[model samples]
Target: MKKHLSIFKLKPLSMLCFTFLILISSCKKEESDPNEQLQDGNSTVITDLAGDTQAAMGSATPGKEARPFYIFLFRLKDQKQIWIRNATDSAQWLKGKDWDLAFTGPYNSEVYVNDKKYRYNPGFEGNAESAVVMLEQQYDLVDQAPSDQVFDASTITKIGWASSASANGWFFYSLSTHIMQAIPNRTYAIRLPDGKYAKLQLINAYKGNPPSVTDLNWPAPYFTFKYYVQQNGSKNLKTK
Candidate 1:
């Protein structure tokens, strides 16, 4: 037995090499690409707008109500986003200065736009306090324009009657027109502060899993919309 030496014996150097290989393998498994977790594309989904009936009616302060209109912040380059309750009590306004775009609404089914706080009134046009520009719809152009096309804000000057009427507001169930509902496939476009373009289409405005009027959850005024922000610095709707 003393005359034979087995070459198959596990040497200390072999053990060390084996352990080093395992360490390298473990490190590789732990490593991950940073971009893997990031959201791809230039689109975002905003599932809800914070304000309830009491908040919309101006009965309660911005953040004190059960629900409050949200101050949406949209940036194009990196796609940074922020959504907060509109602060009506302060002079700061619901529209943030750093924000490229802002939206407020579902107030009686009417959505309002701050348009970068460009001095637009949310009330009826021709009224002494009416805004210079309001969010309106163009039924004829709906078919003409591509569904994903971006829209110019300069083109949206007047508040359409369908968007401001009683019982038949822009997106309520009582509206006679099907396009007026905040239902799926209804798309809207807007121009950003830097003259860029963006588009939004409703997904779900009701509460609960399936979404229904009976599950409306009035006090919670939830809103959901899919939005796309144009990366190029052009006003062209077709450009991404």
Candidate 2:
């Protein structure tokens, strides 16, 4: 079974303990803000993030200026992926906002999903509740590569961004695959407090599936990632 973080309000002492644990777990030392006049420089085109090793956000579809957090993703009540914006980076369009973290690949794996869901192995592991939150470990996402190259799963990767909030840590969906075999590649382009953009990702990384899935099921609630959206009509980076 996976660990589940109760959303219940913590008492003073419990809250303090949790905070202490978080501090000890984080692995990344904070960095100074990287905001400067962009000068509207020329945007470059990257073939792939994983394969090329040196590509970045360019003039792709709607990810204008390489910002994909504005990139969106969603599902209808019927569970079909919905279009949240008019951008090529649709994957993150609706991200950290209206939806719980879902599988990154397309939903064509419904058969595998259903099979895995109903398997009732009872020994399955991994979930937000059970996620390992090192006090200060840093992380980011991989970019969209060209059709020719693909993201490999063996090296540590990194990226950065001007974020909407102070919260930044490695996020894992316990249901992904095997942890060691799982791919830890995800990139982000965040708008800083000064309206300038930046990028971020994990320090050391991997390319593999989620952890082992022996017996898995849930009770009351399923563990997953939280989302963020603007409460003031305009994009609000404030943490909820």
Give lDDT for model 1. Answer: 0.41
Which candidate comes out best when scored by lDDT?
1
lDDT at 152, model 1: 33
**TM-scores of the models, in the order given:** 0.46, 0.19
Estimate the TM-score for candidate 2: 0.19
Candidate 1: segments with Cα more than 4 A from true spot? 1-41, 52-89, 93-96, 100-102, 105-109, 116-119, 122-170, 173-184, 208-211, 216-219, 235-240
Best by TM-score: 1
How far residue 57's Cα lies from its native spot in candidate 2, in Å, is: 32
CA RMSD of all predictions = 13.7, 20.9
Cα lDDT of model 1 by residue, 1-240, tens digit: 532244236587976787788788777545632222122344565555443435543345554454544444444344455555444522343433344333454342344434432355232231121112222443112322322232332344322224333322235455332222343334456544454455555444443213344432343444455455555654343323
Per-candidate local distance difference test:
0.41, 0.24
